[model samples]
Target: MSTGLAELHEKARAALDPVHYDYYAGGVGDEVVLAENEAAFRRLALLPRVLRGTPTRDLAVDLPGGRLDLPVLIAPTAFHRLAHPEGEVATARAAAAARTVLVSGMASTVAIADVVTAARSVDRDASVWFQLYLQPDEDVTACLVERAERAGCTALVVTADSPVFGRHRRDAEHGFHDLPSGLAAENMRDLPGGPPGGVRDIVMSPSVSWEHLDRLREATALPLWLKGVLHPRDAELAVGHGVAGIVVSNHGG
Candidate 1:
């Protein structure tokens, strides 16, 4: 029997071209961490409990200042148009229907405001978080945080991974650095004169640093979180920097 996740994977594979799928699924270096990410989950085997006297089970979880009917949260992905024409809007609607939070990717094709609107269309009180990619320019990064707050995003997720672009040999083999013109990086384009250089320079944000985290916190009132942290010391440092949360990720590793 196919699980819901398996069905979605099949659908995604069928709907997306090989290049797009590889771009979304591929990871940096040897992809050891990427494989470990799935392997780690499988390591834990759930031990089912015996039947108990219960009429119903409540799945609702109270988070920060909001309540989630489900424990699931949507992970951010770039160029969602590669998966479906509706892009992040479609995923946002699905997340809202499930009463789960949706994290909007910094490289999303749909504008942040539009994604928030899509969530509101499904659930008036949808919980939405905006993922941030630290840009080379401090001003640009600050502006993005401001825009996300204005869009009513509940939190700011600073993706600390991919300071530089990862080398995905699969994408390189197929000359897949380019995305379709209409599906450009919306959030990143909010930069003053737009991103520097040509298409290959997509992930070339060189000026991001720990100090910028302090600047980011000062720039917005939204709770800040550091994603892509793998080391315990990094997690402690994030806590020291006044970060509300830390996402332990290895960038598809």
Candidate 2:
């Protein structure tokens, strides 16, 4: 059996298809950020004190929507079906069993309703947040948000910085764009009052600004959390919009 994440990653690389494996394993150009992520862990100095506490401890933490089983949360990543056959549905079920929150990606392979149903099948208190990708059309964005609400999502996580997708050399080399059959982004495939052919062609508004946040705030009652913030100035802007929280990141910058 795999003893740690490193071992698990190796096993997954051997088990998963090359297209999916590359997508998950590869980072942006030069992968400096990935290197830094590992270096940051190495830089941490653990200071264990004598008689501080017992081995057992409470891991729960209160989030905006509710209490999380642990302080950790699963980041929103696309195409869960690439990793498992059940896709985001299986992820939702696992999150329910763990009593933690799972932020379902907007580009999830499973439908939002199906993910919610899977989580509900295990526990009523399952906390699922929606990672929303705002489109150029307010109507389209609102429709997505409304569907999340109907599907019992507790919060809305807007990926504020990924207005444009980054170029990944690994993905290009592996020809991931060709896409295998049955791997479409199901959440984008269906939206309330949305047009046909899904949103694969939709470009995120490069003009997205604070005013857009105001419009998005009006669109949903769920607590809004902005992800992909890089600078303190941007964090201030998010706070000005009255966002519930800000996830500070440059998205592999």
Candidate 3:
């Protein structure tokens, strides 16, 4: 890790509860992918143009969803309240201030509308995309898409990597299975097959396929982005399915 990031990680470790820290830091299985991700990033070299001194440089970009003042974006991460009290709300605010996209997680501790409101409080034109995993129950999946639409998300980020939960050895060792008291995934409340005020658990299934993506595309007018596609064939398939974009990711691997 870079010196700055290492310092930040150390601070987070020092401040957060052990279980929560492990939940945030640990990846699936023995975390070989995690090590490799860092290794891969280190090997990359950005060759800057030399001898053409400009007064200022612009890093802005325009995507189908919205214009970004910087090329950087804040990708989705789940259950942020465990890390800080303000959680996704604070994250939204920061992203707004930076004039970049904040792909709010489906498993956010705060509700989607509240997160969007928080971002708008900083910049009215701020773009906040919703990140979701397709549920086995189509009704539940549709409900999530509706929620995102109602909350004013500019685009939908469908995470296609996690067909099933990966085995995080650290989490298993630390016995970190559930959120602490009073902190639930707020977006899951009042879902199908639950009490009026109950929250349903998010489900993952290997049965999810391109047909499901097709249905989702038909359901929402918002730009749809497919996340966690690493295979070239899968990328081609995504294009065939008419996704607005493909986020090349390995689900943090």
RMSD of each: 2.8, 2.2, 1.7
Per-residue CA lDDT of model 2 for 1-253, tens digit only, reads 7798789989999999877888888887877887787777678775766885688778799887657888878878888888898999999999888888899988888888899899989998888999987787777788788889999999999998877777888888877774468578777765545567654544576877778888898877889999998888888988888999998766654
Across residues 6-119, which tens digit of lDDT does each residue of candidate 3 receive? Answer: 788798999999999888888898899999998998798878898777888899999878889998899999999999899999999999999999999999999999999999
lDDT of each: 0.81, 0.82, 0.93
Instruction: Give the higher-TM-score candidate: 1 or 3.
Output: 3
Sort every candidate by lDDT, greatest first: 3, 2, 1
- The candidate with the higher lDDT, 2 or 3, is 3
- State the weakest 10-residue window (summed lDDT) of model 1: 195-204
| lDDT of model 2, residue 75 | 79
How would you order the candidates by TM-score, starting with the best?
3, 2, 1
lDDT of 1 at 61: 90
Clashes per prediction? 3, 0, 0
Model 3: what TM-score?
0.96
For model 3, how big is the CA root-mean-square deviation? 1.7
Best by TM-score: 3
Judged by whole-model lDDT over C-alpha atoms, candidate 3 comes out at 0.93
Q: Candidate 3, which ten residues in sequence have the lowest lDDT sum?
A: 1-10
Q: Candidate 2: worst 10 consecutive residues by lDDT?
A: 194-203
